[model samples]
Target: MATRNIYYKSKTGILHWLGLAIAIVLLDQISKIWISHILHYGQAIRITSFFNLILVYNEGAAFSFLASQSGWQRYFFTAISILAVVVIVYLLKKHAHQRLFCLSLALILGGAIGNLIDRSLYGHVIDFLDVHAMGWHWPTFNIADCGITIGAVLFIIDELKRVRKS
Candidate 1:
């Protein structure tokens, strides 16, 4: 059986994705701002036994990887983020009718935009959430990173559902 377009008559799908993306970006920025003003670098506000808010600045990709490349990583990361945004837009356009797919892409787009904004405006991404176990601490991350992580998981789930139906 063929799936008739569920969202052909309206642009709700596109708007939905755009809305989510904007919301994520806004929330990410606001949180970063709050963290910056409220907490000093390396200061931690313990939230639980395993979680804390640690003010951190990341100059590289996720997990603070390659954050110390003598300042050359900013442009490289910015270029990569731009490319990712282009690809995400393409995917959003192509799968606009697929709500789950569009949503997943939108989440990722928002995250990319969030971090890209940081990279372009500040030359670094601000990370705050810090999880730890015993003496080891997980990498700190922000709302944008959370958005990306959620989006990736949602994409995987959507794909699996589609496969199961097929």
Candidate 2:
């Protein structure tokens, strides 16, 4: 007798992962909205001895790469994020049975879409969460950035586990 995975045989399983993605997007957007409503642009609110909540608008990729460039980078990054969402969706559908892989893709998909919405509407992504230690401050980031970073790390771990299994 052989064991069968029902999740891979039905559409509902895929929807379950998609739902996770949607939830991430909603949470990301809500957090951004709350931050915007409470904080003025470039304003920082101390949360802890080593952390603060601040408002920042990022017009470029991670760590504000190309943020100082002309306006063209906005369109470029938006397009790239849109393309990444498409790819992540496709991967999710194809490998939904692979729990960790699908989870990683779903998180990335949600994060990508969350930032994409901001870029399309405001030409920049809103960032609020900030961390500092020893007089050094890390770049400000938001929920979407957290999702993407965590997802990327999970993806690497999943790949390593897969390689080990093989």
Task: Please give the CA lDDT of all the candidate structures.
Answer: 0.90, 0.91
Clashing pairs in 1: none
Which lDDT tens digits does candidate 2 get at residues 1-166? 9888664475547798889989999999999999999999999999899999999999998999999998999999998998998888888878877888888888888899999999999999999999999989889999999889989999999999999999
The prediction achieving the highest lDDT against the true structure is: 2
Clashes of each: 0, 0
The stretch of ten residues in a row with the least summed lDDT in candidate 1 is 6-15
The estimated TM-scores of all candidates read: 0.89, 0.93
User: For model 2, which pairs clash?
Assistant: none
Give me the displacement of residue 29 in model 1, in angstroms. 0.2
Q: After superposition, how far is residue 57 of candidate 2 from its true place, in Å?
A: 0.5
For candidate 1, lDDT tens digit of each residue in 55-163?
A: 9889999887789789999999999999998998888877787888888889999999999999999999999999889899788999999999999999999999999
